[model samples]
Target: MKLLFFVPLLVVALVASTFAQQASWRPVDTKILSPWAAEIDPANPHPEYPRPQMTREDWVNLNGLWNYALAPKGAGMPEAYAGEILVPFAIESALSGVGKTVGKDQELWYFREIEIDRSLRREKLLLHFGAVDWEAEVFVNGQSVGTHQGGYDPFYFDISEALQSGKTQSLAIRVWDPTDEGPQPRGKQVNEPRGIWYTPVTGIWQTVWLEAVPEHHIRSLKNTPDFDNKQIRVQADVAGATAGQRLRIRLLADGTPVGEQLVANQEEAVFMLDAPQVWSPENPFLYDLEVALMDGKKVVDQVNGYTALRKISTARDANGIQRMLLNNEFVFQYGPLDQGWWPDGLYTAPTEEALLFDIEKTLDMGFNMIRKHVKVEPARWYYHCDRMGVLVWQDMPSGDMGNRWESRPGVIGKGTEKDRTPESEAIFRKEWKAIMDANYNFPSIVVWVPFNEAWGQFDTEEIVEWTVDYDPSRLVNGASGGNYTLKGQIMDMHNYPDPVMPDPQIWGDQQVIVLGEYGGLGLPVDGHTWQEKDNWGYQSFKNETELQERYSRLIQDLKPLIPKGLSAAIYTQTTDVEVEVNGLMTYDREVIKFDPAFLRNKHQELYTIKIPMK
Candidate 1:
């Protein structure tokens, strides 16, 4: 496996006075608020450490209130900030306190006071942003630090040189996101949101922090688990690496070292575990890892992380239909289409607690998997899934829609693929690869979905081939609910209201057959909706009993297809998003339309349905 990555800029220790300064900032009023909305403290928004897979002891959380201004596109640093917009929350979101839209015509400008503690001044200071939509240019003490593009990937800059005479330095940022106007991967965001489309999220929507690291440190870590062979592959990208430097790795089970190895810098280390414990949804297990950068016997730098052993592939059954296998066995994956959106925060969740709520509720409903629909979540989201045992089908956030797709689900690529401009195609490829590279280590992500519903889908075969070549450990869903092509390991089709499967006889031989989406039974709870007048679902019901009956019927309609070779099924959604009420839960996450116990009971049966074996 290749670690196509960059120097990961991360966060620093949140000292006392920095958080206490943000007490006055507050979220603006919103139509619907999640239960965790009230708990948001502007002084310490998303206080949890941003990166979980790789652990660092020291970092500053730059998430509190920041001075902001919306200036004309191609504008320079603002002379005066309009107001304080909470860091990590998009300007369009209520949590930002400035619920205004910034488009192609304008840039979102942010300025804040950053104080690097006197103790950490000697080391290299790295600035990290969890994600900034579209494009971002940063400055320190009025000097240009760096610029980054692509909306959904983590990026950073080394600001050690930009520091001034004192600990207090001025940080300024200029961001431009065109949303629907440009060909960038904006996912469901639209200039004007309605139905499935959502509000634009301009500027930073994830964590912003700073870290101090030694000259020689791990830039990034890549671990690949081969469950079938009972071995794991590990490699590290090191900063300030020299020819004589070495890498030491210790793999532990229950904190007890099982294997240790030393390899030259940039060399892959393969550690074979004696009877490795397989990680699965039933028993999600993880091995602790300690890695060190060494110059001979002297330890230069080290970090703590973890890895899981799991394999995702396709296998044949008795009838010769390919099944989606986990560790060489069919698990019959089933889950909901999880669009990670919040009414108050839009692109950013109100809090880390709120961020984990959807995942926790997903498991409560007995969902074995979740199709993270056209949105790349924070690293912690995938980290939570890895620990809690849920399979993730990660999507490349869709953009440049209006491309024509095949008219019928049975048809495979009757329409021409979209012809994107050179700039547009490059953005898609760069962001997709970066999204994969940044998230390659999480074992919970079993599949990589490049296109959703044919939105921004170009060079289908070539792109799918690149994805497979990039990471062969996970299965690839060529185009979920999009124009099907004779590529990738899985063929996915979308249907509404009723659970219908593409005839296994037609698609099973070439790819693993699955229903990407079905069963959208909507019932809008009165006060818990984004809007009261125009609530919608594929199949709408008036009452709880009616919704339950319709949903149960849909599940019953899907069970028989599993035995007939439907390898997986994803329901329409996890929660109501904006005006789309076709979710098991309401948009605010205040109400579960149906009892979780009842839904879990019906879903468990789908996993038990056995297919014919040869």
Candidate 2:
């Protein structure tokens, strides 16, 4: 990926003073904080290029300090903002500089002066948001540009027309997030926080930036890998595409050209690769991708990306028991029910390093997979997983989740689906598809989890059927620990403290058996607790030694179950969230109760187990 830097001399001289301007800004007091919190510089918080999967050389970062205020939902823009709130951090977060909640009746407003370098704003200037909670309406220099809904997916507005003829432009955004009050896809967020639910995250919680592209530019890319055919299929979208427009796609392995293709705009391009290295936990080889829009001979737009070859499916074993297969081989997937959260930032991590730390620590502790529990992370998180060889079971964040997990002997989890209004259903459908579309390119994601534990589980058969129809490339976990109709490729069961699998004697031949959740062993370190007193966990231990001993026994109990039919298993979580202390690491991420070497060595055996065949 190429990142071209061209900082003018005048701007270079003022860069040093930017940090000093925010010297007084400090993270509000929290019960605990990650090590990265202390190192945050407001001038360039989360300075890393946000969209690693889609990289452009010339772009301006629109992060840092921004004036913000809370107003009544129906009220117009505030006459005056109370103070500066950090962009990309939720207003309810300690890192946001204004730790306050914006309930369903209120709307959060943000205003910031954006400096658009005339040189960088060539033909088109687009404002990009990694994500904004609930709904957001954008205004450039007080001119309404566009409005976007859905809190977890990325969106942008073409602000080129709204730009004023001035050195700096005014940017304002009005956001309304209902958290649990509204029927949106807000995962694990509640106004009244306790037990499994945490504090509400309102307004912007991810990177906001600016990009420069030609009039006719590549808007998005969806690359699907055909492992059986040894080819990659691409569906590209170009904004302002005109007649005679063509897209050039080139593939490279270690800088050596592998293949190239030129196709007309809006056409799918299939590039061949002979015997490419397959991506897996063992070898996560990524090939460079160069894409460009060609107007005659000259390149109108270009963006750099990467991809890999991988496949996921299920096959029956000799004993007529279905098993999960990755790249045509049976490898047991075991990982944590990773609830991505931070004590300081809540839904947002303090820094990119803080985000990468969770993935790195998960791998260090010997897990190859992570069930991104009921949450969608920033693009960079998936990019890290793709590069680091960590398999992801991406969950659609649960919302409108009051339905009971009702089921009978058979008949597609009958009487369990929620009778949601059409608006709620549409919101779920639109957001789920957007999330899938946004994250489809990453090979790390092997399974798509539509509903979790019957929360917002509606139209089970239709939803699962549609998911399979939409993208047949990956397996679908119909309802992870939810109302399982046995329609998807996986039949997951939720067990606590002890590991268990769906009985192979009965349901083993129909779908891949898995322990969707188990092993919630908790040991909260003193001084690192989210609160002073009560904390929650499925099983609590007094000391580190006791926690480690019980975890070892849990794994000892989990291994033999794989031979019967268990395809995969997910532990409770990666880190302690709020009062739930079941994580391997503490909420502050200051301590790991188990030794990494011992844990990894113990887990390594489960991957080698094989079921007997017919």
Candidate 3:
């Protein structure tokens, strides 16, 4: 959130030619070489259900195309639309059909018209945006309906009152994203992108749609799977309902009823399952769920959902060293440092297939986990992780205050820790809690990381404890690879181009040893980079063969550390991010740097599961 100051002399010249050329961008037909390049269907793009965990078959998909306009700094709503930008892609992204940066001072607007069915008109109409970066003010039928400020979480507005009873309705949105110029949790976005920091996303970057629900509908459902108790707690947050309203929750395994429970109002109800199938990397079993809101006897609202059975905790191993236990067993966690960047969509994936491709590739490479570095992904991303058997270390998007060059170092690391102001601390806490509340239901997310490499880090001990209390079921990485007070589950370290383990003496009993981040082996591919020059990685390679060889050597070196009590290691990244050309895959997902089978075999060799009895 701390604004970076740039001297006037440092400002690059505005190249009108580049802007003009990119503004007319559209999703290219992938019938040629790169078949994986996301294709835009004129009739149905990203028509699949957005929220896989909580799905309803009756909802409409509003994802093909929409009217878009970019107004000047502080300009009011425009009278004429500039052009058609694809819905759900950020205005700055190539897939949006309008690849133009929305600066801190500018406003990005979107307008779309939709018709409601007479059957749906009987129910309340709710408009949902999977996510809109920074700040968004929404208008329904020319009247301001609501305003929401948060980039990562989904939000909705009830527009039943504003709806035209028997005609088509209009929805307009005006968004303002300061990116790194404001004190909000803008993940890795920067005005002048370099290294890990990449392109900024402004306006709607996720699915936007409408759902018709009864007046007293089930607003939100939070399901917590407790393997320790062998029970799944279901909590329904109902809207427009009274105290005595009854809701029935049914749990099913492979579509067969396993358990059922009836609860009233917003209370936590438990459904006990017999011999529950616990979720793990090898077998990620999820139980189907259905919730119905009842008004006396008539069913008023219903929502279909799912939950996984899993547990994460810390326990001392045979050597008296603390270790992270998944499903009650010590498993050495090895995963990529996922930056969650898309070549075409920036923060948003061009298509759902593209989103799943990253996860599938990660799994194919023989890693069972991924440290989702500094960003929270869409709910469906986590849902895929749950289904595909991958563990996730979720980092709370950081904000507040820090020096770009100091706190976030390039070649060297050195920074004076600045105390966070009371106001900044309050905002940080609010956003952190909101993020947890939104993502606590995910089973694949076994760890909650509060700070990364000391970026805007403050009150480490207290915040770590707060995270532990917030969700006792998961482990907390107090601080990953930075100024550490040694107060969390993992004593994390960051050593790029080389791997390093925390001192066993200092954190022998307090925390599990982990190489939080390492091995940024860079290989930039031509015509697939955000910028030609100024690209970097910890170690740069000329081609894929060299990259794979160096990566295999790094993994071989990591094998000795596991016996030394190193429980986990997160490699630099899963895919190339903007200027950081160090990933298993290229930025556009056009190349796989290493052979998946070979990489998997190398990773499996490090685990104790395959070690011979000598």
Candidate 4:
């Protein structure tokens, strides 16, 4: 948490001109642009710290103008630089200044020069990437460092060995993304943008940076809260832990120390709290954590983070109907099917403020939960949710959409599974576990959604069983809006234009009943639509009045199901994506189709009702 040393004056003067040169570069003009695009400074695009949970003050942001080239897939490295592209923006995005698609046969290349301050590069220099599209191979000064796959998870390479013995170092990255051509976990991305699918995001689309750490520093932390025990269980993975080094953890409430623990070379540590405040939507309490690796009196490494104490489970109501219980209370969860997409940024939001807007707006609509449909947002999004008390249903981005799904009223059927190759299954398994582990510390996520509408559902019983066993902290919705396995904690149903719930007679005693998706009321704002014509929604509306009336009626119809056994419900979406105009807000986030106050008032009925828990 504290800077080890001060920056040299010579280094500051040297990098000032480099930042100016970087800022002078500009993005190419496009047909449409978001409001944040105009305020972007190439020198500091997404300059905020990428990882909030793991904070280190001394780090270099590698987001700026970078040399780029597109070559054949197996071409290795390009002989010549093609042009300059923005570091964090996707190559296909207009904000990148090179709106060119890298097809299945092509590989995208990025080159940049990094000025390393000798003072900051102490014992180890680590390069961190928030995310890269499909696959990325890193090179430092033409020396191959490492290769990483999976587009949605964070990865880092120890570039200390590859750094040259000079003030400046050359960094190059080669990437290959197949979009929908391969069976990777790409969420709704395609070469051809259509009704539900959007443009392909190739190459780097997230913040890249470099950090300095000790030789034996903490690599990652997994915090699990035990409300019953009134203590927090922490697992700290150290990169180069030595024999005598110990992990010291200090828990803080509002910056004041509450408890402390010192574990001897062990991976796990427990901190007891005097009076722990339970985390919920109403309280949203968070405790600061200071973790360090110490050798007696000297501190080797330290990082600051925060966590919350909460629990999610299921219980039966007075009528013997199963319902979702958050922290032992039967509070109904209702939220929109949040497809985290931006018109200007596509898969990436223009800024942190832009990304936080969706969550803030969701809460303003009086909804406490959000189903992040088939997309994983940056770590900061979950951090915001933790701080703001918004419950999340995190969905594993769907891939390998080559299966037939069967679902009918009053019938629970096992859908035909896709016969995917072993390689495909392995890829899915690896990425899903990585995603879960990466976000396990966040207390806001209440449910883990593995499959959505059976897009690539396979080995349903095994996958669900494994997922439930992997992290028993949160409830598992095996396949939201997909064929029900009736194995996990929730039996979900999908119905459009009206709210619907699973039959309580069949699944009420076993699993919680929920409306996975419903009420896609569409009203395309003329100027804010993705396309001029043929914009689509599940149910189309001509004006705001009609849309608002239909939405109110849907909620009105949904009230009766609460007595029957509806646990939760998800509306169509948070915002309009591409040509799909069913969002509460438009694609450009310019207008809210309904009055926020009126919608908030309508949503209150679902949350305020108290169903007796048996």
Candidate with better lDDT, 1 vs 4: 1
Compared with the true structure, all predictions reach lDDT values of 0.86, 0.86, 0.78, 0.86
- Per-residue CA lDDT of model 1 for 1-614, tens digit only, reads 11111111210112123334555565566686665656667778899988888888778899988999988987677899888998889999987888998879999899998788986676788899999998999999999999999999999999999999887999999999999999999999999998789889999999999888888889999999978778999999899899999899989999999898998777888989887888999989999889999888998888899998999998899999989999988899999999999988998888888889899988998899999999999999999999999999999998887878774545444455788899999999999999999999999999999988888788989999899989999999988878778789998888877877777898888899988988888887777788878989988889888888888888888888888889999998998999999887888777777788888999999988876655
Clashes of each: 7, 3, 1, 0
Q: How close is candidate 1 to the true structure, as a TM-score?
A: 0.95
Among residues 3 or more apart in sequence or in different chains, the pairs in candidate 2 whose N, CA or C atoms overlap within 3 Å are 318-613, 318-614, 319-614
Question: lDDT tens digits, residues 453-521, model 4?
Answer: 898888888999999999999999998878679778988888877876767987899999988888889
Q: Could you report the Cα RMSD, in angstroms, for every candidate shown?
A: 6.5, 5.9, 7.0, 6.7
**What lDDT would candidate 2 get against the real structure?**
0.86
Q: Model 4 residue 76 lDDT?
A: 86
Give per-residue CA lDDT, model 3, range 1-614, as digits (tens). 11111221221122223234444444532111122332545345677777777776567878867888878766877888988888787887766767788888788889988888887677787788888997899998888899988888888888888987667998889999888887777778888876567778888888887888888888888988888889888889888887667999899999999988789878787978778898999999999889999878888889998898888887877767777788778788999999887776778776678789889989988999999988888888999998889999999887755733232212223344548778668767877887888788788999989988778887878999899888887888887876665566777778877777766665757888788888999887765566767778888988877777898789878888787677889998897887788888777676677878888999888765421111
TM-score of each: 0.95, 0.95, 0.90, 0.95
Off by over 4 Å in 3: 1-38, 72-74, 401-423, 531-534, 609-614
In candidate 3 the C-alpha lDDT for residue 199 amounts to: 78
Give the alpha carbon lDDT tens digit for every residue of 196-268 in model 2.
Answer: 9999988898999999988899998888889989987776789999989899998889899988889887788
**Sliding window of 10 residues with minimal summed lDDT for model 1:** 2-11
lDDT of 1: 0.86
